[model samples]
Target: MNIKKKSALVLSAATVMLGLYTGAAAQQIEKPLKKNTATTFAIVVDQETYNKAKQEINAYKSALEKQGLGTYIVSHQWTKPEEIKVVLQKLYSDKNRLEGAVLIGDIPIPMVMDAQRLTSAYKFDQARFGFRAAVPSDRFYDDFNLKLNFIKQDSLKAGNFYYSLAPESAPEIHPDIYTARIKAPAIKGKDKYELIRTYLSKVVAEKEQQNRLNHLMVYSGMGYASESQTAWASEQVALREQLPQLFRAGSSAKFVNSRMQGDLKQRLLTEVQREDLDLAIFHQHGESDVQVISGYPNVSFPQPSIENVRRYLRNKIQAANRKKQDVAETKKRFQATLGVPMAWMDDALTDSVVLADSLFEANGNIMMEDVDKIRSNVRMLILDNCYNGSFHKDDYMSGHYVFGSGKTIVAMANSINVLQDVWTTELIGLLQHGVRAGNWFKEQAYLETHLIGDPTFAFTAEGNTDYNELIVNKDGSDPVWKQLLKTGDADLQALALTKIFYAQGAASSSLLKDVYYSAADASTRMQAWKLLSTLNNADFKAVLKDALTDPYEYLRRRSANMAGDFGTDDLVPALVASGIEDWASKRVAYNSGNSMSFMNADLVIAQLQEYLKKPEFAGNTDIQRLIKRQEGTREKVLKEGKVMEDKKAVAKERAFDVNMLRTYTYHELVPQAIAIAADAAEDHKLRLAAVEALGWFPYSYQKDKIVALCDQLIADKNSTAQLREEAMRTKTYLLHFSAEKYQTVAKK
Candidate 1:
C-alpha cells in the first residue's frame, strides 16, 4: 500500500477502536466526582489498550482515589497530540484543577522542534533532519504557557506529530501540570497490553503499602565530566542537604562508583535488586537500548598475569575479526607485544574457550536484553543520561524498567542528549515532603526530560503536612509562605521562597538575597541564588560576586559557570580568584576557564596579572599555565568564529560551530553572525543558522546589536523568504525574552 492509503487505513482503525472502547468504557472509566480546588488527576490512555486492560485500569484508579486524588481515566483513540493538549488545558482551567496526568499505552507523541533553548542540551538542524531532529516531548500537553504552532504529523509514524514552540510564547518552561508516560515498550514476543496490565497491577499493589523516601543508592559511571571526582563528590554533599534524613545516623544512603568494583555490572544488579532500596540514580551515558556504565574493567596496568594478557588478546582478536580486519595480522601484532608463540595465537583465535571468556568479561554495560532477566525492586530509578527515556522507540531502557517484570514503577530520564552541567537533583528534597515524583520532575522542566511511569507515585511523607496538597490547592498566601520559610525543613523553606518569587517577582529580591546569606542550609542558600539569578537585577551581580566564594562548592561552581553570560568586568576579579583557588576541583576549574573566554579578555588578563602578584600565589607554579590556557580558549573561540563564516569549510561542520556559539554565547561572534545573515549571496542554510544562533544571546550585553540586525533583515524587501522568516523568529524571541527579564525588574 502507498503511504496515503496506509495512513487512511490507520485512521479508520483508530476510529473504530475508539467507538468500541468508549461504548465499553462508559462503565469502567471513572469520571471525576469533584473538580473543586485541584484535587483531580488524569490517566489518559489509547482506546485499544483501555479495552484490553479495563479491569486493571479501573483498579489503578481506585488506588489513586484511596490516596485522596479524584481520579479520571480519560480513554480515547488519540490521533493528534493537540487533541490531548486541548483536553488537558480544559481540565487545567475547569473547576477540577488538574494536578498531573499520565499518558499510557500508545498515546500520540509530540515531537517539538525549533526550541532548543527549552532543552537542557539538545540542538539540531531541524531542516536537515526533519522530524527526527525534533524532541519527543509531552511538554506540548502540560505546559499551557507555551504557544506551539502545529507543523504536521509524521508521514511515516502514525502517532508522531511535529510542533514548534512559537517565538511569541513564554521564554521559559513553567509547566502548568505534571505529566508522565506509562507506555509499554514495543518488544517482540511480548504483548504490550499484557505488560500494561501487569504494570498497572504492580502500581496498584505498590501504592497500597507505605513507601518511604529512605534507602537511596547513587552511582557514577565513566565518561561523565571525564569522571570528575569533584563533581561526583559534590553531588553526594548536595544530596545530603537535599535528603537530610538519609544522612542521619541509622538511615542508608549508599554511594557506588564504577571503579570501586572490577565487575560493577553484577554489583549494580545486586544493589538494584535489593528490596529495601528505595531509589537508584544512574549517572552515566546511555542510548535507547543500553546504559554505558563503564569502559574496560579495572585490571593491573603496566604488568599483568599471563591469563589476563591472554584474555585481552582473545577479545582484541575477536573484535578485529568482527570488523573485517585481518585476524592473522591482529594476532601477530599481539604476539610481538607479548612474545607469545604463533601456536598460542592460533589457539586464542580458534578456541571456543577464548570466546566464552570474552563474552563473560564483556559485561560492563546493561543492554535491553539484560533487562528481562532481573526483577529490579528499586522503587524509583533516575537515568541521568541521553535517550534512555525515549518511549517512542520499540525497545527503550526506561519503558522496559517500568513495564518489564520488575517492581520499578517510575523512571526519570531524557529523550535526547542532556547537559552534564544541569542540576539533576534540584528540588529532589520535595520527594521527602510527600510530593509526587512527577511534581519533582515538573519543577526542573526541560523539553527533553520526562518521567516514565505513574505521575501520582509518591513516597510516604516524613513530615506532618503533605506539601503536594498545599501546592495543588493553590491557596498559598504571602503570610502562609512566610511562615513556612521559618520552618526547620530547609527544602520547605526553599519551596516557600519559590512560591513567593513567582507571585511577587523581583519584589521579593531583597528577601531572597537576605536568605542567601542568613540561611544555614545549603539547599535554601542554593534556592535563594537560583531565584535571585533568574531576576537578573543589580542584586544578581552582587550576589554572584559573593557566590564564587560561597561555602557550598556546588553553588560556587554554578556561579563561575554562569558569570560569562553577564560579560561584565566586575565579575572578572572573582572569576580569576575562583579559577586559581579552586584549581584542585576539576569541574570548577574547567567551568571557570571556559567562562573566561566569553568575558572581556583584557579584563581577564589584567585580573590574572594582579592574582600572580599576590604573596599567596608567589610559589604557585600553575599560575602561568592557567594564564596560557585562558589565552588559548579565547584563541580557540576566535578560530571557531572564523570557521562559522568560512564558505570553503564543510557546511555541516560550519553549522556545528554556529550551534556551539549558541551553547557558549561569545559577544565577539555576534557581529560575524550579523554579517553572515545580512549577505544575501551566502548559503541559505548557513544564513538561517546564523539567524537562529543570534537568538541565544539574550543574556549577552550585546543583545541590542542582535535585535537591531534581526529587525533589519525582517524589513528588507530584497531578503529571501527563508531569511525573512527566520529573522522574524529571532526578533520575536529576543523581544519576548527581554520583556520577561525586565518584567521582573519592573516588579522590583
Candidate 2:
C-alpha cells in the first residue's frame, strides 16, 4: 500500500488495540486520579519560541482535560552537547510511556536523530505518535526501525492556497511555483529579494487593511561562517548596500537594518528612530561577551586586549583587602564595607585574592567599555549568530544583562557556528502567512518548514530540547501553533472567558454579554453564549430576542439550557413575543426551568407574592424551596448576636455568587461582581467578602473602591491570609489589566 494507506491502516490498528486495552482495564481506568500517573511530554525550542509554545501547550492541556484526557508537561533546553545527550537518554528510557513527541526547531534535529537511534536499543515502541518540524531522512526510520510522518508544503504552494482563499479584491494572483522565480529578475541583485518583496507587499497590504503593522519585525543577518577578516568586511559592505535597496520602495514602512557597526545600543539608536521603531532586527556574530558588528572588518580588534588590565587587578586586591578588614569588624558594618565585592576565593597569605580580583576587574572593564555603545541600543535584541550563550571566562554573555528600559526577545542559534539565516528567512515567510494567528513560536515553526522543506525543525530552549519535542504536554494541551491559529481575531473577550472557565468554573453574565457584543460574527457570539450557558442558567429573554432578530438558530438552541436556576420565568414571555409556540415553546420552557434553579433566588417567593390571590404559584416546589432557604438563613442571621462575623461571611459568599453570576456577561461581569459586593447587605463580613471578590475581577472599574479596600484590608486586624491574598491579587490584576487595556485602547 501507499504511504497514506499504510498510515491509515496503522492508525486504525492502533485505535482498535487502544479500545480493547481500555475496555480490559476499564475498572482501573474508571477512576482516573486527578493526581499521579504522570503524562509527560517534551519540546525542543529556541528561547524566543519557548514561552509562546508553553502557553499554547498549557491551554491545550486544559482543553484536553475538559474532554477527560490526562496530561502533564516537561520542558528541556538543548544547546549544549551534554544537555542533548541527557534529553535523548530520557526519551529512550521512557519512550514506551511517552504518548507523543513534538520537535519544534532545526537546532534540536541532530539530537532527535541521536534519540531515534537509541529508541530500538531501549525497546521503545515505534507506534507512539510524534510530530516534528524537520522531516528526518529515510535512515531515521530505517535505522530506528520506526515509522515517521512528515507534514510538508512549499511556501509558494501555501501562498497560492492563501490567494485562492482570500477575497478576489485582495490582490488576486494565479497559483504557480515559478511565479516567484520569474519575478526574480526584476530584483536580481540580491538573493531572495523577489520573495522578500512579494512577502512584504502582502504583509503591508494586510497591515493596511488591519491598520497596524506593530506585531512583527524581520531579522536578516550575515548568512554563513566568517572565513577571514576580509570576508567578514565584505559581508558587512554587501549588507549595508542591500539595506538601502530593500527600503527604497518601502520607505513608508518601518525597517530595522542589522548592518550597522559598533555598540548595539548605538546602532539601534542610529538606524531606528525612537518613535517609529516597534521591532528590532540583528544580523551579526555573537558569543558570550560580544556581538559582532557587520561593518567591523577585523574580529581581532573587537576582541578584548590586555590594556588597562592592571586596574582590574588593583580593584580586585582592594575588594579583598576590604573584605578582610571587615572580617575583624562588627558583622553589619563589615558586610556593608565590602564595597561591591567580587565572588572569588580570598587567600591573604599569597595575595591570590588580589591577583584574582585584578584579573576579573580588568576583564570586565575592558569588555564593558568596548561594547558600551552597542549595549545601550541593543534593546530587544534578536541574536542571529551562533553560540550566543557561551561563557566569557567566568560570566555568561547572552543572559547576563537586563534590557534596561525595554523588553528583550532574543533568538539565538545555540549550536557552534550554525547558520541561522535559513531559519530567519523561514520565520519571515511564516510571519507573512500569518499562521498560529501570528504567535511568535508557531510562526517560527511555519517559517522553518518553508525554509528547509522539513516538518520537524524543533524550536526550543538550550536545555529543554526534549520537552520541546513533545507537541502536547503530559496534560494533553494543544500545540502552540494550533492555539494561535484558532485565535484569528485576537478576541480578548474569548481569551478572558477561556482563562476564567479554566481557572474558575463560574464567570460573570455581564462579561459573557460583552463577549457576545464584541464578537464579529454570529458564530463567535453563539460560542460565547454557549460557554456562558455552561456556567449558569441561560437568560431566556436574551436568547429568544437574539434568536428572533439574529440569523443563527445554532446560537438560539445553544442558549437553550437543560436546567433552570433563576429568572427563567422570562423565557416563555420572550418565546411568545417572538411568535415561537407549541413544541418549541415547551422545549424553551423546559430548558429554561432546568437552567433557573441554580441561581439561588427565591423564585417561589416572587411567584407567591404575585399570585397569592389566584393561588397559581401555591404548589411550585422550586419557589417553596427557595423561599424556605432564604427565610431560614435570614431568621438565623437575625437571631444570632454574631451578626458582624456572619454578615462578613455572607458578604464573602455573595461575592462569590456575583462573581459566578457575572461569568455570563463578557465585559460587564467583573464590574457587576464588584457592584453586587458593594451593594451587599451591611454585614461587615459580607462587605469584606464583597470587597474581596471585587479584587478578583479585572481591575478596570471602581479603582477608587479597589484601592480603598486594599488599604482597609491591610489595616484590618481581622483580615486573614485568604483575604489578604485576594486583596493583593486584585491589585496585581488591576495593574496588569489596566496597562493592557491602555495599550489596546491607545492603538484604537
Candidate 3:
C-alpha cells in the first residue's frame, strides 16, 4: 500500500478499535453519573513514543466518544519526575471532569501516584491505569484502592526472538543462559515488533539478490527493530528506486540498524564481516561497567563478573587495534560505510546494587558486600527507572562506609517506584534533538527550567557532575547545589524555604523566618524576607530592613518587605522610606497577653504604658492587676537590696549603678537589676553573685533581658537586640517625663 493509504488504514482501524473499547467500557459501568462531561485521559511519554501512544490513545478516545462516553487525550513530554506532578495537577484542576487516567512510562507513574494522593485528599473516586514497567503496588494500593496493571518486558523475550530468527546454520543457541534470562509474561507490543523485524530482514535480503531491486519499504515494524539495519535496508532500496539519477550508480549502499541487543560485540563483528554491515545499534540495560544483552530463559550476557567483562573488553580492544583503529573511530567508520549514522536508543541503566544499597542505608540497614562495587563502577549513572532516586542516605550507606572520591554522576527519581520507559526515551530524544540543533547544554537547562518552575526546585550535582568545569564559573563560585545545600542550617530549615516552596502546605512564615535567622548566606536571608512579605505578620519588618542593606545586592533587590500586614507602630520610619510597596499593609494585631510571650519586658512595659493612657485600659480590672503586681515586685526588690546570697556584696552594688536608673518609680528599679545580671565581670564568682542579685527583681521584668544577654554571650556578640531595645525604651521614658514636667511649669 502507498504511505498515504497505509496511514489512513491505521487511523481507521484505530478509530474502530477505540469505538469498540468505549462501547464495552460504557456497558460495564453501572454507577450513577455525578455530572455529564467529557473526561480527559492524559498520557506522559517521550517524544518518539508520544506519536505512537498518542495515536493509540486518540483512537481509544474516539471509540469512547462513539459510545457516548466523553474522552479526551492529554499528552505531556516527560523530562523529569516532577513534571509528572506538574502536568497532573494542571489537568486535575482544569479538567475536574476526569473519571479515569491511563499512565504510560516513567513520568506518568509518579504523576498517577500523586493523583491518587490528591484524590484521597479531595475525597474523589477515580480509577487509574499504569502501562509500562511494573510498580510496587503495595505502597498506594490500600490507601488509594488502585487497580494496577503493568507491561513486563525483560531480556528473555529479547533473547528468544533473536534466537528464533538466527540462521539455522549459526552457532547453537544456549538453552541454560544465566544472565540474560527474562521472566514471562513478555511485553505485548515489544514481542510483536521483534517478530516482524526478523521476518522482514530475511525477505528483503533474498529479493535484493535475485531481482536486483533498487530499494524496499517495510511497514508495521516497531520497538527495537524499527531502528535496526533491516529497516534501514528497506528504506535505502525504496529511496534508490524513487530517485535513480540523484544517487551515483556506483555508490556503495549503506545499512543502519538500531535497538540491537545480545552479545553486541560479537553480533556487530559477525555482521561487519558476513553481511558487510557498516553500523550496529543496540539498546537495553546499561551501567558504567557492563551492558545487558538478552539470553535464553531469563539469562543476560555480560553479567556483573569483573573478570568476564574485562576479558570481553580486552578482546574488543585487540580487535579494534588489529583493524588499525580505536573503538569509537571504528564504530564511526562502520556507520560511514553503511551510509547512515548508527543510533543506539535505550534508557540509562541504574545500578541495582547502588539502588538497593542506597535504600538499605537510608532505612539504617547495612549491606556491606556491594559497597565497593557501587563506589567503583557506578559513576555518572542515571536512574531513568522509576523509584530509583527514592533511597535516602541510610538506605545505601552506613556512617562507616564512605563513598569513594570518583568522577560519577547519579540522577534518579526521588519518589518510590520505577518510572515508565517512555519518559526516559522522550527525555533522551529531546536532548538529542536539541544537541543536533546546536543547543546541547541549553537543552538540559531548558528541561530543568520546565521541570522546576520556581527557584526552589534545585538542580544539584552528585559525584563527577558536581566537579565539572562547566558547573564552576571562572571566578570559582560554588555551584548551584552547593549554594543551595549551604543555605540553611539543617535539612528541615532547607526544606521550609527551598524545596517546600514548590510543594504546597510545606512551610509557614514563622518557620521560614527562623530559617532565615539561621541562614549564613545573605542571598538566602533575603529569600526569607521575600517569603515573609507574603504573610500578614509584624515580626518580619525589622529583619526585612536589616536584609535590605545587606552586603549582597541580590539580597537588597529581592528582600523589600515594606508592606503586607505589618503593624504601623512596629515598622521603623527608615523602613518606610525605603520605597518598598509590593506587600500588603494590614498587620496581625496582638494584645498584651500575646505580646508578653514573644516580646521583652521593656517592649511590654512600653506597650502597657500606652494602653494605660487609653480610657478602655483605665477601666479594665486586668490592667489594674498588672500595674499593682509590677509595683509590688519593684518595691520588694528595692527593700531587699540583695535577696540571693550567691552574689558578692561589692559585685551586686557595682552592678546596680544609680546612673542607669533614670526613672525614680519603683518599676524603673527592675531595669537596673537586669543590666547588672548581664555585666561581664573579671571574676566568675562575682558574675554569678551579680546574676543572683538580679534574680531578686520581679522575674517577669528581668527574665527576657537576662536570657537575651546569655544568648549573646554564647554567640560571642557584644549585646542582644533585647538589650538595645531596653536602652531605647529607657531613653524614651526619660524624655517623656522631662517634657511633662516642663509643660506643668509653663502652665503655672
Candidate 4:
C-alpha cells in the first residue's frame, strides 16, 4: 500500500455514536415505535430461504441491531415487484419505523425494458437495421415511491430494483437486471450467504470504526466525446474550491485530462487496486464493460481534434461541402481543421490499447478485470454512467468485472440521465457529514422526488401516456404551486407553467403568447412554443420568427424545430445559425439543431435536409417525431440528452447506424451533409453518420452521383478501414452495385 498524505480526522455533524451492545440476540421491532427510537430498518427475505437459513438470517438482524437499528424481518413469496413496492411503501408511510430495507436471498429483480425506434447496435452482421428497445434502468429498486421512466411510445421502461442472490445467473431471468455492486463469493468458491455476511460485516465496521482515511482519488476521463470540446469534462477548479471544507487539504490525487502520466486509465487502476485508497471518483462516460477514459494518446489527440491529411488535400476543390458550411469549433473556436483518429474502438480490445503486462490479465485491454482480486480496503466506488452498475457476481468471478470492485458501488441505478454535478456534490457533502455509502442513492431518489415531484430519472416526449395524470392535479399546496402563484423564481415558475398546461391540456393563444414572449425561464419559453403549436398557423409562424433571438439555446432550438415542421424554407439561414449555436455544449442534437430535448434535434437535422426538398413543397410531415408528448420543457430538453447519448458513439465503437436507414434518401441538404462527410475536422461519430446518409444520397437528387461516391470511398487507400468497409457494405446491401454490376463501368 502507498500512502499519499497524513491528516487529522474531523468528526462529522451527522455521524452517529454507537453504544456497545455485547452478546444480545436479534429482536424484531414492530409498527408504532416509541416516540424517540434512534434508527429503523426492514429485512425482507425469500420465504423459502428463511426455512434453510433462519439462524443465519437472525445473525443479519443481530448485526444491524448492534449498529442501533430496530430491525424487522419479514418473509414473502415475492410475486410481483409491485407487491414489494406496496409493502415497502406501506412500511415507509409510517415515517417513525422505516428508514431503509435490505433484500436477502433469491429475491427476483424487476426490469425496465426500453423499446425505442432509435437505431440500436446491430447484434451481428445478419441483423437488419431497425428500431429496438433495451432495459436501461439501473436503479429500479431504489424508488419504492414508484415512477419507472420507461413510458415513451415504443419505449417500455421498467425502473424496479430487486437484488437477488439466486443460484442462477441474472441473464437467465432477464438480460438487463445486473447489479455490479458486489463481488459474489460464488466465484471464490465461497457460499453466497457467506458473501452477504461479509458485505454486511464490512459495512457495519466501516460505518462504526473511529479510524478514518482522508486520501481520495478524483478521476475525470476526458476521452473522445461527440467532439473534443464537448468532452464529458467539467472544470477541476470548481472541485478545488469546494473540497477542502469537507476533506483534509492536500490529501487528494486527481487524474484529469491535462495532467496524465504514461497511461491515464492504467495509472488510476494501479492506485485503485492498492489497499490504501479510501475513495475513488470517476467523472466521465462509462459502460457496463468499460470506462471511457483517456485512451492511448498515440491513438487519440490530446486536443479537440487531430489534423486530417485528407481534408487538406480535398479542401481546394470542394466548395459546397459540409466542412465549408460548418462554423462550430473548427473555424469559430479552434482556428484549425481536425478529424477523428484512425485508431478504432476495436483497439481497446487489442494491442492497439496495450497495458502493462503485469497489471493486465492475458486478454484484458484498457478495461481492468480485477475486482475479485481487490486487496484494497476501499469502502465506496462511484461510476456515473449508463449500465455501469449492471455488474453481476458471475462476471467478477470469471474475471470480467468491467468497473467492479469489492467496495460498495455508488452509481446510477438505471439507464437514465442524471445531472452528475448536482447529485455527486450532494453525495460528497452527505459523506463528509457521515452518511453511509449503502444509503446514498436511497437519499438521492427520495430527494429527487421532493425536488421535482417525480421518482423517475428521465422523462421523454415519446410514449408517456401517463404524463398528464402524473404532473397535473398535484396538491394545491405543493411547492411548485406555491411558486407559480406566489413567487417569481424563474425555474420554479417555469415548472409551474408546464404543470398547469399538463393539467388543463389547452390554452388560449393570448395566454400562451404571454408566456412565450415574457416568461423569464428559457425552458418556459420553450414550453410555451409547444402549446402555441395548437393555435392558428399564422400565430405559430410568427412565434418561431420571433424566437430567432431568444436568449437561451433551449428556446432557439425549439423554434428551429417548429420552423422545420411548418416548412418555413425562408428561415434556412436562421436554422443553420441555431444548429451550430454553442455547438460544444453537447446537447442531444449536439451542434446541430436543439429541438426540445432529443426529438427536434433529430427532427431538425434531417428536417434541415427534408424541408429543402424541391425548394417548393411546404414543410413535409414525413419526418417522424419520436417523442411527441413530454413532461415540460426541461423534460423535453434534458431528457432527450439521455435518449440520444450513444452507448459507444465514435466509429466502430458502437454498431453502425445511419439515421437515413429508414428514409434511405437525400434531400437538398445532401450538400450540407456532404460537406460534413467530406470534412476532416468533424467528429468521427458525426462523420460516420454523415457517410451513411451519403450512402443513400442517390435515393433522390444525388442518384446520378451514388456510383461515383461509392467508388471513391472504396478506392481511397487513405480512408479509415471503417469508412471503406461501410462503403462496401452500402454497395453490397443498399445499392446492389457489387463489383460484377460495375465491372464494365469501372473500366471507364
lDDT: which candidate is best? 1
lDDT score of model 1? 0.79
lDDT of 1 by residue, 1-748 (tens): 8999996674344332212222334312346543343467888888788889988988898788778788777777666776677767766776767889998888888888888878887877676787778998888888888888899988888788888777567767778889999888876688988988999999999997887888999988877765767777877877887898898876799987776756788888888888888889998888998888776555676444555666667778778977999998887787788787666556655668765766665587888777777888899999999999988777799887888777898999898889877777877889987898877787777998999988788899986776776776544344778898888777888888887887767677898999998998877888999888776677777888999888777788889887887777778888988888887677778778878888877778778878788998875667777678768877877888788678788878787877677777887878888888888888888888889989887657877888888889878998887777777777776665432554543210
Model 2: lDDT to the true structure: 0.33
Q: What does candidate 3's lDDT look like per residue over 620-702, in tens digits?
A: 55545544544554455454444322245564444333321211212334454554545654344433333333222221233
Q: Using TM-score as the measure, which candidate wins?
A: 1
Q: Arrange candidates by TM-score, descending.
A: 1, 4, 2, 3
lDDT tens readout by residue for model 2, 1-748 = 6999996674344221112222223101111113333332233333333333444444434443342334333333333322332343344345333232333322322213112211111112122222221221212211222222222333432211010011111111111010000011111133333332332233222222222123223333332322223223333332222222223443332333333334434433444334333234444555545555433222333223222232333444465557775432333343356442332222322477556645543332213234323332222234455444332122333432221112222232222333332223222212222221112233122111111111111212212223322222321123432243254332222333433333333334455566576655443455456445434333423543465334333333324432221223444333322222212333333333333332223443454344433465466564445456545644443333232224455544443443333222112233443443344245444444445445433322345556566666656677665455445545544443322222222100
* Model 2 residue 271 CA deviation in Å: 59
RMSD of each: 6.7, 31.0, 33.4, 19.6
Deviation of model 4 at 616, angstroms: 34
lDDT of each: 0.79, 0.33, 0.30, 0.40
Candidate 3 deviant stretches above 4 angstroms: 1-460, 463-493, 496-511, 559-572, 576-748
Over the stretch 301-392, how does candidate 4's per-residue lDDT look in tens digits? 53422322323223321322334654333222223333333332112223322333223222222343444555434445555433344432
What TM-score would you give candidate 1 relative to the actual structure?
A: 0.88
